[model samples]
Target: MSVEPLQRSAVAKDEQWNLQHIYATAKQWEDDYRRAGSLIDQVAGYKDRIDSASALLAFLEQEEELGFLYEKLFVYASLKLDEDTRVTEHQARVDRARSLGVKISSATSFFRPYLLSLDKQTLDGYIAQEQGLEYFKKELYDQFKYKPHVLSKDKEEVLSQLGEVISAPKTIFGMINNADIQFGEVTNEQGEKVALTRGMYMRILEGRDRERRREAFKAYYKPYVGLKNTIASTLAASVKNNVLFSRMRGYDSPLHRSLFADDVPVSLYDNLLQTTREHIAPLHRYMAYRKQKLNVDELRLYDLSVPLVDDCEVSIPYEQAYETMLAGLAPLGGEYLDILRKAKTAGWIDVREKQGKRSGAYCWGPYGTHPYVLLNYNDTLDSMFTLAHEMGHALHSYLSDANQPRISAQYKIFVAEVASTVNETLLIRHLLKETTDEPFRRYLLNHFIDTIKGTFFSQVMFAEFEKLVHERAMNGEALTADAFSEIYEALFTAYNGELVALDPEVKYGWSRIPHFYNAFYVYKYATGIASAVSIAGRILEGDEETTKAYMTFLKSGGSEPPLELLRGVGVDLLKPEPIRDLLSLFDDLVRQLEEL
Candidate 1:
């Protein structure tokens, strides 16, 4: 008899997230949903009337209340759906919530145009007259920064109405990736051919068996390769749509528009790409080291993932992983640890793999509730590091929510990866320091080196790929599947150096990245790691001032721009030093591994 993967229903109650924290029952969800619907009406009622200071304040307050209700409703529904995606009832709830979300967007689209309509003098006079505007003053004034980009009210509403249609490419790609794509089969331990899964694919990549790694790599890419043209069309449409909006909004380019919200300059993006390429030698040396250590004739892309240190695996249970993570992160101090500890038992984590559960992991929750993490914990060392990474995001959310008001509590996407990387950095450093076993020490170093390779180097490569594709599209070139593959292969060659041999499947890598649909978002992953290296290093060195600043940085949230927040935490990413230092550190780790 075939033993099926455990379904979510059979999972232990304690291993699940208590989504009831947001709603007691389906009835409560319906009540909130109806309330949000009425609130949409109430918010729309104040539309053109938000001319006076008092009227604006009242409108803002009402919108905030509606936002709070809407988030609770949407988040609960979405989380339930993710628990077991096959459930139609939960899917319907999410659809209802999303429908409500779209309405909310349509109703509020007028506010930005209206706010931008006022002259500085008029807005200042209004703020001066109303004490109630104090809470919203910063956010209010911040709208002026987008004055150049804000469309007229009619245009704004039209754009808002077209939001779903405009976002169809991303939605289509997501469905193709998550719901429809299929991988080929691989020979399992039982000598039977089993369909390859994402989890199994990653594990196989890290396995000692070269044949298995090669087989799994081909299997994983089989579906992507087959549907390459379809995926390419989706990505092209997404890019062109971004360029269209950028042109419509009077921005210089799509890249500029992405950075405009965070007040980031074009130079910052360009600098990261150029600087990494300048310092690419260390990565080349490391790639050569991988080839030498693996004793493979040619280091194929598939060969790059298996552990350099073999036969050094450790089985860490979930409970032990949590404890070790707490220990690794203890440098953040008792207060941070206290909250991390509480999250383990407080229904803030969904920590198991089950049939129909969402694949991969993320930290998500609406404001007014603790952050929830969805993890498929498989008792591996990587799983332990994942626990550290996600909880870092969780506490960042928790601290920010507790400290800032609803308007500013949500951090920008640019800084979202920093706190998580800091946790990963610290955890690896702690593990490195504690292990005296030469092989395990080398393994830790290799693991950390590979993390940097994936997170920092590869991301910069992807970012540059984005810039090139978007630039080509902006210049009126066709973004074909072959074009994407050529660009990606060249980048893969440049970034990974000439040491690794390319397989036919390597160029098609771009077809699998979900982030490409999001447009100019992956560059932050590189910047985030640079900042985290500095902050984690200081914290590990007992720099109390930096720790305090980082805590404050977490709490400040989107109240300030991401660059300024990193500056406060003692990392100026605009300068060449942070990236250079991170590269040098990567070099040092690789050299240490070579010595070991």
Candidate 2:
């Protein structure tokens, strides 16, 4: 069966978000590029001319204004580039942004070193002389706080130059995964052969044919395993880069450096993995129950995605999904729902899979334009949930961009996952309550359980694996492919706890996770989901105060620290309640599945 191209006429030309939205056309972007380059030379005037307090304040304000203008142009170009990465023109625009960013970064690089050079009394006197300087006091302090980590300006510049090449390993991995590697065909039980690729892997993995799923898993990982050494080298280089940078910058460890960038406490990340490890019994018990419920003699990796209860397919069309999403989020009040309805009517979504299109989904936009979401819309229950999830991000960006300054508009990745998972949490609650059929309810309950297991426990396991590998490399231990495999195998065995067979093939799991290159990122997915469960439960329970606080958190953007933002939403993520509540939800879902 061939997948048909999505109808683009159904949506506005601008809704598709071609590069024209960034500028009316490519030529305009080029012209702006030249204008921006000229402005870069002007920024040099502020470099070393801040002797007086008034001069310093004027220079700082002017520098920020220039930065905002440059960012507006850069974001537009970069967002356009992400849409169709292969397009030469869009790539040119993206290259322009990167080049300009580096140039501007170099130009402004003196600000931090210069500030750090000032003595405490001199800095305090300057701060007092110009009260307006207080707005940037925190920003200045952040830069100086890393003085122990900051190298000489010349060395830092050399490191900055090395940054682009340092990304090659991960970029190579992405190219191999997205553009080059292909999965071989696996035959179904019906004697039909289906070609396997990353796109089709999920659908195949979810098939009723256990043998086909097994073959699919093997075929998918075979290439990865063959190239394990190369992958290991790339990963080692990336992790080594992190360790080197952290140690150079005066951090105790790479993990500390990574978390410090996002202003997150390292303990929060450590606790997420530790708590998840402690609760492995629940995950194991759920997996055991799933094996029996599905009546499989052996539960393999492929069996993880299959629905426990059949005959209860929740096939939702794009429109119905939109309505359900609107209704599901009505607790957000009329204004929020109206914005959603407008998104639906205004063609904010590109709602079908098309030829030569990107796999997966995302939300993208520049400042002036509202956010646009792209989805393949396969009509599965998970697809609907994804629609709800991406919309959560789009709406968050919309609200934050609307209310905050450009510098503060973009939230950190630490807090970025919360809005999307909160949307998922609300959508699940709505469906569980809206349905009356017992079997369907049971299936939905099972689905919710899988969400918790996959998001919280599985990601936390990955985080543990990531932490171990980094620690090993930091300790002068080699990160050979076999060593990596052994570490992951240990984690899998420990977390699985005999629920299912840990296939020897599963040892190559480290080759497949891209987040390891990202450094200390996967744990946030677990922590974010836990935090969302708390926030969503409160809103679902008609806690008006919590709802208001959550809305405030969304609008607050990066104005405060990530923890402060989350705390405002009534989720004490520092405490253990959110994690315990998440585990309780998983336990309840398991009990429901048992009854079913």
Candidate 3:
């Protein structure tokens, strides 16, 4: 079938997401769901056998089969959920997966607690006893890293059962953000009114008219401010969840627990925030230049996203954008490039905007299937950037799946953004160099500078806010909406001191950022972007060693901790060099824009 026909077939029902790709029909999905249900019963059979090394290994092999099936079922339901929030049937299917998740989790809870319960000698002996299970030794050894806090099986099962409830705060916040709350309309300076949707907010914020950007900022925040208390409570609840989990798991702090969940060190996160704080002067200086160029007397919060060069625009259709991105990423060589081309031809990308579709973009899929990307294409430079970002993730999954076992194919959240941001960095740098048109070059250069600012500096500022909120809550302080606003407002002043006017309403910025609900999540964006900038430079310089190491990082999957994974790829995030390099690049771009 032609691309047009396939596209129509995929989205024929106007469903939130296209699930037909997974099972071809709802009946097939039901059949798979029932198959998953049957597999749940078989898990109980393995419970008793888990104590014996030989029996446990056999059970693990059986469990992997179940896991593979469950992944398909789960991914199908999740993609459906992302496509449209209004699909009740898909919601029920998602709920089914969530509810069954507890069962599958409970069935496997004994594996870790039991392994840790065994003495190191016995565990090592078990590894020595069976060659078949030797490959899993690292997997077990990684679990034992949490040995100090490993709970008893019964307690672990209880935690597993409560997992859904434990994840409620994030779910509630997502529902509110994606399905419940709505921002009112804002009129641009030209008197053209636009609905202040989450997707359009950025477009308006980047408008040339200073007053329109300000109005958009206020109009966007208006609903969030009114609903501030509720959003604050939701965020507070999430923090409390992290705190409780950390305390219960014997971690030192919420941040430690969050980072430790994926084996990330606290030092890396701390270093990122501290380095960004020390370097805020550069960011502020850039912002000051932007204010002068935009000719705003007192640069307000709304003035932040506006481009200094107003008349320039970079617009490319989807196909041209793909080719441009492909050329930029050619350094990865034939194998990696071939995988991306397959992804493009395989209907792996859902690339157009439609009604009721979720805001933002993500690359998602389970094991045994190709990764899928969902994007709202707007034919702007930013839209092209989003495509690059999501494709980075899709390609990472593609490489990991092809290279690693299903058991370890999924990459952790910590290293997840590295791949995506690396693509964006490469794509932006290529655009800057390839396009000689002065106006477009300036626009691309300014856009690159803005990305570094937004993704690296601004996220670090937000991460600081995350750190403060968690620490404050730990110290017997309540995170009321007002209190949050106060803390975040002061942070804004510190972060953008001389650059822009930190409006009081900007205090509620914390309420608008969804990452805060995920606890210590936003920092990764900063660190990831920094690492990407560093890595992209190496690849562009045709450093074969760096390019090979970076591809190895992509293929490493969840086999190693995020820090070690990146370290293996030659970027030591503990030192502040990567971030400094990013800021320096931003400085260069700033000069280039000035020269233009």
Candidate closest to the true structure, highest TM-score = 1
Model 2 clashing-pair count: 1
**Top candidate when judged by lDDT against the true structure:** 1
Q: RMSD per prediction, one decimal?
A: 3.5, 3.5, 4.5
Model 2 off-target regions past 4 Å? 1-3, 10-34, 74-102, 164-185, 188-196, 311-315, 346-360, 376-380, 474-478
TM accuracy, model 2? 0.88
Clashes of each: 0, 1, 2
Clashing pairs in 2: 149-249
For TM-score, candidate 1 versus 3, the one ahead is 1
lDDT values for all models: 0.91, 0.80, 0.79
Better of 2 and 3 by TM-score: 2
Q: Per-residue lDDT for 205 in model 3?
A: 78
Error of 3 at 353 (Å): 5.5
- Please report the TM-score between candidate 1 and the true structure: 0.89
- At residue 515, candidate 3 shows an lDDT of 80
lDDT of 1: 0.91
Model 1: residue 522 alpha-carbon error in angstroms: 0.7
